[model samples]
Target chain A: MSITISNISKSYKNVKALQDISFEVKENELFGLIGPDGAGKTTLFRILTTLLIANEGTATVAGFDVISDYKMIRNSVGYMPGKFSLYQDLTVEENLNFFATIFGTTIEENYDLIKDIYVQIEPFKDRRAGKLSGGMKQKLALCCALIHKPKVLFLDEPTTGVDPVSRKEFWDMLKRLQQKGITILVSTPYMDEAALCDRIALIQAGKILEIDTPKAIVKHYSKPIYNVRANNMYQLINSLNDYEYNHSVYPFGEFVHYTDKRADFNQKELKMYLETKNLTDIEIEKTIATIEDTFMELAK
Target chain B: MKIILYIIQKEFKQIFRNKGMLPIIFVLPLLQLVILSNAATFEVKNIKFGYIDNDHTSTSRTLVEKFNASTYFDVLTDFPSEGLASSSMLNGEVDVVLEIPQYFERDLQKEKYNSLGITINAIDGAAAGVENVYVTQIVQNFNQNLKVDLLQVSDKQIQPITIETIPLFWYNETLNYKTFMVPGILVLLVTMITLFLSGMNIVREKEIGTLEQINVTPIKKSQFIIGKLFPFWVIGIGLLTIGLIIAKLIFDVPMVGSLVLMYFYTSIYILVILGIGLFISNFTDTQQQAMFIAWFFTVIFILMSGLFTPIESMPEWAQILTEFNPIKYFVEVMRMVMLKGSSFIDVLPQIIKTFLFAFIMNGLAVWSYKKTT
Candidate 1:
C-alpha cells in the first residue's frame, strides 16, 4: 500500500469532521475519494499529506508515518490545495521558477515532468497568474505541484469548479503521472469520476460507508432497480412514491430511479397504478445500477 | 540557507512588482517626513489673550502692555466683567483669560501675596501645558521688574543668595522644533513601513491562498520567515537614508553623528519591528485583522516613544512601559546620534537594548510560526 490510513478521526469544537476513517491506496493507483462537500474528503487528504494531525489514529504515506515522518512525507508528496494557491502577483514562469527553487530544484532539473503542461502555458508565461483563465490556472497549479517530482500526489477536489473539458484533460494528466509509478489520492464530488478510479471510497458526514471498485460498488446493490419516465417527471415521482410496494424513489435525470419492496414485483401493476393517478405517458423498465444509485443507497 | 535566499529573491520581486506597494514604501514615508515634521511641535505661539481689568489702574494696563509686547500673546480684547471675559473664552475667542481683582494693585503693594486669576483652555492637554508654562514665565518677569524697580537705588541683582543660572540648551541652542522632530519622525516612518509591510505581506499570502501552498512544501519555518523579512529590511534601511537626505537638503537638519553607526543601529532596530510584524502575521488569519492589530500596537508605541512628547515628562509607570517599546529606543538613538553628534559609544547602550529586543522578538516569531496546525 502506498497510502495507509487506520482509524483516523478529527473534530472541531462541537463538529466531528472525520471519524475512525480507514482506507488504503495501492502504488501507482488512481484512488478517488468520492463524496459531496463537507464529507471529510479534504480533511482526510490534509491528514495524509501531513499538513494536519489526526486526533485518534495513525496514517502513513509512501511508507512513512504522517506525524512522525512528516518531513520525509512533505519532501516526497505534492499537494494541490482545494483553492487555487499559486502566487497571483507572480507571472506564470516566475511562479514556476519560485516553487522549483524553494524546493531545492530548478526548472531544468524537472523539465521532463512539467514539459507538456508548461508548453501549453508557455505562450502566456509573461502574464500574471491572477489574469489567467480558469482552465489555464488549473493547468499551471498542476504543473507547479508536479515540478517537484514527488512520490505521491494528494489533490483535494482538483476537478471541482472546473469546466467539463478541462476536468477531463486534468484527469488525463493524472493518468499519465500514474503511468510513471506515482500513487494518486484524489477527491471529487462528481459521481461520474468514481468510475474512473481503480478503487473508490464512498463517504458522507465523516464516515466511509463503503470502499470498493466502482463496478463492485454498483454490483452490491441488493434490490432490483428501475428507470421510469413520464410526460411530467415531477408528478411521476409523487405518483410512484404513493404506491404501497415502493421501497425507494428518487429522480435520476429523465428517469426516476426506483426499487420495490415486493417479493414478486410486477411492472404492469406499477404502470397501472401510475396510470390511475393520471401520470400519463408513464414508462417503467428495469435498468442496471449506477454509482449514483449505489451512493444514494449507501448514504440512506 | 540556499532555500532562504530563494525566498528572499522571490519576496523582493513581488514587492517591486506590486504597483500599490512601491509608492507607499518609497514616496509616502518621504512625504510624511517633509510635511508631518512641520505639523508636530511643542512650542506654543500666538496665544489668543483676553483679560478683565477690574482695576483700571496703571498696574493692570502695564501688565496688559507687557503681554501685548510679547509675541506669544495676541491680546485680543479687554473685558469689563468676569462674565464677559468667561463668555469670550466660551465662544473660543481666546485660549487664556487673565482677571485682575478689584484691589487696584493695593493687595500686591500691601501684602505682597496677591494672586492673579489665570484661566486656560485645557483641551489638547500638551498644548495647554506649554501655554501655562509661558504664562507663568511672563508673570515671573513682571515680578522681577517690580523687584528691579525697588532695587534701582541699591543694585540690579535681587541678591538673597545669588546663584545665577545660565540656561543653555545643548545640541539644540535655539530649540528648533524641527531639529528634534525630524529624527523622531524618521523613526516612525521606518517602523510604520517595516511593520505594516511585513505584517500585510505575509497576511496577503494567507488571504490569496498561497500560504497553504508554501506550508505544504518542505521549506523550513525559519527559512520562510527570514526570506519574508529580507526585502522589508532593505526597504527600512532605504527609507532611513531617504529621510536623512531630505532632512539635510530641505530642513538642513544637522547630521553630526556618523551615518555608518546610525545605519548599523537602525539595521538591528528594523529586525525587531519586522519580527513583531511577522509574529502578528503568523497568528492572524486575515490581512485586515493583521493591519488592525499592527495599527493598534504601532499607535501605542508611537505615543509612548516620546515622538511628540518627552519620555521623562510622562508618569513613572508610562516611562517604564516605554522601556519595553522598541520604537522608544530607536527614536532616542536617532535623536542622540543625529543632533548631538553622538559617537558610537554614546549609542552603545541603545544598540545593545535593541539587539536584545530583536533577538527576543525574532525568536518568538520563529517559534510561533508553524507549518502544521
Candidate 2:
C-alpha cells in the first residue's frame, strides 16, 4: 500500500470534521475523494500529508508513520493545496528553483519529470508568478511539487475555480503523471470527475457514504429511476409524492428525476395518474444511474 | 543554505522590480539626512537685540559697539525710550535689550559702581540663558578696557578678576549634528524597510492563496522560514549600503570607522530587523493590518530610541523602558562604530543585546507559524 489511514478523527472547537475515517490507496492508484465544500476533504489531506496531526488512530504514507516519521513522509510525498499557494513575488523560474532547492534537489536532477508540463509555460518563466493566468499558475505550482519525484502525490481540490478547459487539461496532466508510477490521491466536488479516478469515496457531512469504483457504485444503486417532465412540473412532483409511489423527486435541470418506492409500482399507472391531473407534454422514461444518482441515493 | 541563497535572490528581484517603492526606500533617507541634519544644530546665530540709550554718551556708544562687534547678537534697532525697547521685547522681535541709565559714566567715575538695565526674553529658557552669559562676558571685557585706559592718566591701579573656561568635547570634535544624526537615521531606515517588507511578504501570500500551496510541500518549517527571511535580510543590508554611500556623497559625513567593521555590525543589525519582520508577519493575516501594526510600533520605537531626544533627559521610567527597544542598541552601535571608531570590544554589549533579540524574535516567529490542518 502506498498510503494507510486507520480510525482517523479530527474536530474543531464544537464540530467534528472527520469521524473514524479509514482508507488506503494502493501503489500507483489514482484514488479520489469526492465531496462538496466542507466535507472534511482538506482536513483529511492535511493529516495524510503530515501537515496536521490526527487526534486518534494512525496514518502511514509510504510505510512511514505520519507523525513520528514526518520527515520521511514529507520527503516521499508531494502535495498541491486546494488553493494556489506559491510565492507570488518570485518569477515562475525562481519559484520552481526555490522549491527544488528546499527538497535537496535541482531542476536538472528532476527535469524529466516536469519537462512535459513546464515547457508549455517556459516562455513566460521570467514573468512574476502573481501576474500569470490562473491556468498557468496552476501548472507552475504542479511543476514545483513534482520537481522532487515523490512516491505519492496529494492534491486537494486543485481545479475548484479553474475554467472548464483548464480543468480538463489539469486532469489530463494528472493522467500522465500517474503513468510515471506515482500514486495520486485527488479530491474534487465535480461528480463527473469521479469516473476518471480508479476508485472514489463519496463523502457528506464528514462521513463517507460509499467507497468504490464509479461503475460499481452505480451498478449497486438498486432503484428504478425515471426522468419525468410535464407542462406543470411542480404539480406533477407534489401530486406524485401523494400517490405513495414516489421514492424521491428532485429537479435535475429542466426535468425531474424520480424513483419508485415500491418495487411493483407500474409506470403505466403513474403516467395515467399524471394525465388525470390534466398535465400536458408529459414524458416519463427510465434512465441509467450516474455517480450523482448513486451519491444522492446513498446520502438519503 | 542553498535554499536561503535562492530566497535572497528572489527578494532582491522583488525589491528592484517595485518601481513605486524603490525611491522611497533609497532616496528618502538620503534627503532626510541632508535636510534634517542642517535643521538639528544647537549653534545659535543672528540674535536680534534692541537698546534704549538713555545716557547717549561715548561710554554708552562704546558699549553698543562692543555688543555689535560680538558674533552672538545683532543690534536690530535703537529705541528712543525704555518703553519702546521693552515693547519690542514683548512682541518677540528682539531677544535682548540694554538700558544705559543717565549719568552712567559720572556715577562710575565718582562711586566706581553703576548698574545697567538688561532685559531678556525667557522662552526657550536654555538659549536665553546662554545669550545672557555672552552679554555679561562682553560687558566685563568692556569694564576692564575702560579701567586700563583710565589708569594710564591717574595715579591709581585697577585690578580685574576673570574666569577662563575650556570646553573639551569627546567623540565628536566639531560637534556637527549631521555626523550624529546620519547614523541614527540610517538605523531607522533599515528597521522600517525590513519590518514592513518582511511583514507584508507572508501576508501577501496568505491573501493570494499561495501560502496553502507552500504548506502542502514536503519542505520543513525551518527551511521555509529561512528561505523567506534570508532574502529580506539581504535587501536590508543593500538599503544600508546605499544609504551610507548617499550620506557620504551628499552630506560629506565622515565614516571614521573601519568599513569592514561597519559591514559586520550592519549584517548583525539586519538580522535583528529581519527577525522582527518575520515575527510581525506571523501575527498578522492581512497586509493592511501588518502595515498598521508595523507602523504603530515603528513610531514608538523611533520616538523612544534616543534618536531625536536624549534618553538621559527623559523621566526615569521612560529611561528604563528604553532598555527593551532593539533600535536603541542598533543606534548605539552605529554611532559608536561610525563616530567614535569604536572597536568590536567597545560595542560588545550592544552587539550581544541585539544578537539575543534576533534569536528570540526569530525563534518566536518560527514557533508561531502553524501548518494548518
User: What TM-score is obtained by chain A of candidate 1?
Assistant: 0.97
lDDT of 1 by residue, A1-300 (tens): 899999999998889999999988898899999999999998898888877888999999999999989889888999999899999889999999888987888999989888878899999999999999998998899889988999999889988889999999888888888888889989999999889999999999999999999999999998999999999888888887788888889999889999999879999998888888887887888999999999998998
Those runs of model 2 whose alpha carbons end farther than 4 Å from true positions after fitting are A230-247, A260-282, B40-160, B202-212, B215-224, B363-373
Output the worst ten-in-a-row residue range by lDDT, candidate 2 chain A.
A236-245
DockQ of each: 0.74, 0.42
What TM value does the first chain of each candidate achieve? Answer: 0.97, 0.94
Q: Please give the distance, in angstroms, between residue B49's alpha carbon in candidate 1 and its true position after superposition.
A: 1.3
For candidate 2, what is the TM-score? 0.82
lDDT of 2 by residue, B1-373 (tens): 6766665576667778888878877777667766766776666667898888888788889999999998888988999988888888888999998888999878887777899898988898877888888889989999888887655444453454667788997877777778888888888888888888888887877787766656655656676777777777777788788888878987777777787877787788777777777777777789998899899989998999999888999899999899989998888888888888888888888888888887888777777776232
User: Candidate 1 on B191-268: residue-level lDDT in tens?
Assistant: 998999999888888898888788778888778877888889999998999899899998899988899999999999
- For all candidates in order, the CA lDDT equals 0.89, 0.84
